[model samples]
Target: MILPALLGLGTGLSLIVAIGAQNAFVLRQGIRRQHVLPVVLICGLTDALLEVLGVAGIGLVVERAPTLIEAIRWGGVLFLLWYAWGAVRRAMRPEALAAAQGSEASLKRTVLACLALTYLNPHVYLDTMVLMGSIGNAQGDPGRWWFALGGALASLGWFALLGYGARGLTRFFATPRSWQILEWCVAAIMVVIAARLAFGGIEV
Candidate 1:
C-alpha cells in the first residue's frame, strides 16, 4: 500500500511538474497576487476529480468518445490562441504588462480562466484521466485507492507550493521590463502548447 501510494506520488509529480499551460497560468496568477487561493483550489480539485474518474474506469468511456476529445481540443486551441494574442499585445506594450503591477482580477473572471486552463486542454485529460488512471488501476483494487490518494495529495501540494511560493519572486517582477519578459515567455508557452494540441501532440 505504501509502495503504491509513494509510486503514485512520484509519478504524479513527475507528470505535473512540467511547465504546462495550467502551471504557467498559476505561476502568473501567483506572481500577480490575484485570486491565488481560488485558482489553486480549482486546479487541485479538478485534478483530483479527473484522477478519480480515471481510476473509476471512466477513462475507458472517454477513450471511446473521440468526438468529445476533439471538441475540447478545438476549444482549447482557440482559447490558447486568444490568450497568446493577449500576451503578445502585452509584451509589445510594457505599460500593459505594468497594468498587472499590483492589480487584482475579478473572482468570477479569474475562476473562469482557471477552469478554461484546466479543462479545455486535452493534455489534462490525457494525463489525469488516461495516464494517471491507467497507472493507478494497475495497482489493483485496494492499492489503486491508495494510489489515487497519493496522486490527489500531490496535486494539492504542488498547486499550493506554486501559488504561494510564487510570491518569493515578487521583488524580481517589480520592473516593467521583467513583466514584459514574463509575458513574452507566457505567450510563447501558450502558442507552443496550442500548436501541439492542434497537431495531436501532448508533450511540451
Candidate 2:
C-alpha cells in the first residue's frame, strides 16, 4: 500500500512538473495576483476529473481510438503553434504587452479564459486520462485509486505553490527585456513540444 501510494505520488509529481500552458497561466496569474484562487481551483479540479477518467479505463479507450487520437494530436499541434506565435508577437511588441499590465476583465471572463486555456488542448486529457490512468492500472485496482489520489494531490500542491510564489518574482519580471526573454523561451518550448507531439512516435 505504501509502495503504491509512493509510486502514485512520484508519478503524479513528475508529470505535473512539466512547464505546460496551465502552469504558464498559473505563473502569470501569480505574478499579477489576479484571480489566483479560481485559477488554482479550476486547474486542480480539472486534473482530478481527468485523473479519475484515466483510472476508470478511459486510457484504454483512447489507446484503441487511433483516429480520434490522431485528430486530437493534430489539433494540439496547431494550438501550440498558434500560442507560440502569440508569445512571439507579444515579445516583439513589449508596449502592447505592458499596456495590459492591469487587466480589468470581469471575473466571469477570467474564469472562462482559464477554463478555455485549461481545456483547449485535448492533449491534456490524453496525458492525464490515458497516460496517468494506464500507469495507475499497473498497480492493480485498490492501489489504482491511491495512485490517482496522489497525482491529484500533486496537481493541487504544485499549482498552488507556483501561482502564489510567482508573486514575489514580479519585480524581476517587470522589465521589458525580462518579458522578452521569457516570452522567447516560452515560444521555443511551445514549438519544440508541438513538434515532438506531431512527429514523435508514441511510447505509451
Candidate 3:
C-alpha cells in the first residue's frame, strides 16, 4: 500500500528531474515570468491525468498502437526543431532577447505550446503511460491506485517547483548575456532531445 506509493513517488521524480524539452520550456516560462500560471497548470494537470489513465490500464492499448506513436514522434521532432530555431534566434540576437524580457506571450499561444510539449513527445507517453503504467499495475489491486496517486502528486509538485522556483534566478538573467546563454542552453536541450526522439525510438 504505502510502499507502492513511496515507490511511485521515487520513480516519478527520477524520470521527471531530467532536463527534457518540457522541463526546459517550463524553466524558460518561469524565468520570463510570463503566463506562468497557465503553463504550470497545464503541465501539472496533464501529467496527473496521464498517470491516472496509465494506472487504469491504458498502457496496454498504447503499446499496441505503433502508428500513433510514429505520428507523435514526427510531430514532436518537427515542433522541437522549430522551437529550437526560435531559441537560437533569441540567443543570437541578444538585443531582441533583452527587449522581449518585459514582453508577455499570449495565453493561447502559451497554452498551445505547453500542450504540444506534453502530448507530442512520444517519450512522455512511453514514460508515463507505458513505463509508469506497467510499474503501477505490477503493484496489484488497490496498491496500483495508491501508486498512481503518488506519481500524480510527484508530477504536480515538480511542475509547481520548476515553474515557480525559476524566479530565483531573476537576478542572474537580468543581463542580456545571461539571457543569451540561457536561450542557447534551451536550444541545445531541444535539439538534443529532438535528435534522440528522431533516432533513438521508444528505448529513449
Candidate 4:
C-alpha cells in the first residue's frame, strides 16, 4: 500500500508539474492574489474527481474505444498546438507580462475561465483519465485505491503550494524577461506534449 501510494504521488506530481494552461492560469492568479483559494480548490477537486473516475475503470473503457481515443488524440493535438502558438506569441510581446499584472478580472469571470481551461483541454483527459487511470489500476485491487488517494493528495498539495506560494515570486515575475521565460517554457511543454500525443502514443 505504501509503495502504491508513493508511486501515485510521484506520478501525479510528474503529470501536474508540466507547464500547461491550467498551471499557467493558476500561477497568474496566485501572483495577482485574486480568488486564489477558490481557484485552487476547484482545480484540486476536479483533478481528484477525474483521478477517481479513471481508477474506477473509465481508463479501461477508453482503451477499448479506439475510435473515441483517436478522436480525442487528434483533438488534443490541435488544441495543444494552438495553445502553444498563443504562448509563443505572448512570449514575444514586451507588454504581455506587464499587462497581465494590471488586469483584475471578476471572480465570476475568472472561475468560468478556470473551468473552461480545465475541461476544454484534451490533455487533462489524457493525463487524468487515460494515463493516470491506467497506471493506478495497474497497482492491483485495494492498492489501486491507495494509489488514487495518493494521487488526489498530490493534486491538493501541488495546487495549494502553487496558488498560495506564487505571491512569493510576485517580484520575480514582474520583470518582462521573467514572463518571457515562463511563456517560452509553457510553449515548449505544450509542443512536446502535443508531439508525443500525435506520434508517440498516449502512454505518457
Candidate 5:
C-alpha cells in the first residue's frame, strides 16, 4: 500500500509539475490574488475526478481510441500555440502598472476560465486519466484505490502550494517590466511545449 501510494504520489506530482495552461492560470490568479481558493479547489477536484474515472477503466478506452488520441494531441498542440501567441502579444503590449492594479478578473470568470482551461485541454484527461490510470491499474485491486488517493492528494498539495506561493511573488510582479518578462517566459514555455507536442515523438 505504501509503495502504491508513493508511486501514485510521484506520478501525480510529475504530471502536475508541467507548465501547462492550467498551471499558468493558477499562477496568474495567485499573482492577482483573485479567486485563489476557488481556483485551487477546482483544479484539485478536477484532477481527483479524472483519476477516479481512469481507475474505473476509462484509461483502456482512451488507449484503444487511437484516432481520438491523435485528434486530442493535435488539438492540444494547436491550443497551446494559440495560447502562446496571446501571451506573446501581451508581453509585447505590456499593460500599464495602473491598469494592472485596477484590473481584477471576476470570480465567475475565473472559475469558468479555469474549468474551460482544465477540461478543454484533452491532455488533462490523457495525463490524469489515461497515463495515471494505466499506472494505478497495475497496482492490483484495493491497492489501485490507494494509488489513486495518493495521486489526488498530490494534486491537492501541489495546487494549494502553487496558489499560496504566488502571493509571495506579488511584490516582484508589481512592475510592468517584470510582467513583460514573465509573459515572454510563459510564451516561450508554451511554444516549446506546443512544438514538442506537435512534432516530437517523446511521450509523456
Candidate 6:
C-alpha cells in the first residue's frame, strides 16, 4: 500500500516537474505576485481530477477518440502561439519591475488562461490520463486509489511550491532586465511547445 503510494508520488513529481507552459505561467504569476493562489489551485485541482478519471479508465476512451485529440492539438497550438506573442510584446516594453506589475492580470482572466494552458495541451492528457493512468491502474484494486491519492498530493505540493516559493526570486526579478529575460524565456517555451503540438501526433 505504502509502496504504491510512494511510487505514485515519485511518478507524479517526475511528470509535473518539467518546465512547460503551465509551470512557466505559474512561475511568472508567482514572481509578479499576481493571482498566484487561484492559479495554483486551479492547476493542482485540475490535475487531481484528471488523474482520478484517468485511474478509473477514462484514458482508454480518450485514447480511442482521435478526433478529440485533434481538436485539442489545433486549439493548443493556436492558444500557445497567441500566448507567446503576448510574452514577446511584453518583453519588448522592458519596464521596471513595479511598472510591469502595475497592470496585473485580472483573476478571471488569469483563471481562464490557467485552465486553457492546462487543458489545451495534448501532452497534459497523455501525461495524466494515459501514462499516469496505466501506471496507477497497475497498482491494482485499493492500491490504485491509494496511488491516485499520492499523485493528487504530489500535484498539490508541487504547484504550491511553484506558486509561493517563486517569491524567493522576487528581488532578482525586481529589475526590468531580469523580468524581460524571464518573459523571453517563457515566450520561447510557448513557441517550442506550440510547434510540437502542431507537428506531433498523439499516439493513444
lDDT for every model? 0.89, 0.81, 0.89, 0.83, 0.84, 0.89
For model 3, residues 1-204, the per-residue Cα lDDT tens digits are 899999889999988989899899999999989988888888777777888888999988998999999999999999999999999998999888878998888999989999998889998888888889999999999999999889988888998899999999989999999999999998999999899888887662
How high is each candidate's TM-score? 0.96, 0.86, 0.97, 0.76, 0.88, 0.96
How big is the positional error of residue 110 in model 4, measured in Å on the Cα after superposition?
A: 4.3
Q: Which candidate wins on TM-score?
A: 3
Model 4 root mean square deviation, Cα atoms: 3.1
lDDT of 2: 0.81
Please identify which of the two predictions, 2 or 4, would achieve the higher lDDT against the true structure: 4
Model 6, 1-204: lDDT tens digits are 898888888999999999899999999999888999999999899888888899999988888889999999999999999999998998998854458676776788999999999999888888888888899999899999889888899999999999999999989987788988998999999999998777766666
In model 1, which regions exceed 4 Å deviation? 201-204
lDDT of 1 by residue, 23-101 (tens): 9999999998889999999999988899889999987787777888889899999999999998898889987667667
lDDT of 5 by residue, 39-103 (tens): 99999999998998899898778767877767777777776777788778778876564376468
The residue pairs that clash in candidate 3, if any, are none
Which ranking of candidates, highest TM-score first?
Answer: 3, 6, 1, 5, 2, 4
| Residue 19 miss distance in model 5 (angstroms) | 2.6
Tens-digit lDDT track of model 4 for 1-204 = 899999889999999987777888798789878999989998999888888999998866766777776777787678678878977998999686689667777999889867866775556777887888999988989998989999999999999999999999888887888889887887887788778878887543
List residue ranges in candidate 4 displaced over 4 A: 1-7, 18-21, 106-117, 120-123, 130-142
How much is 13 displaced in model 6, in angstroms?
0.7
Poorest stretch of ten by lDDT in candidate 2:
96-105
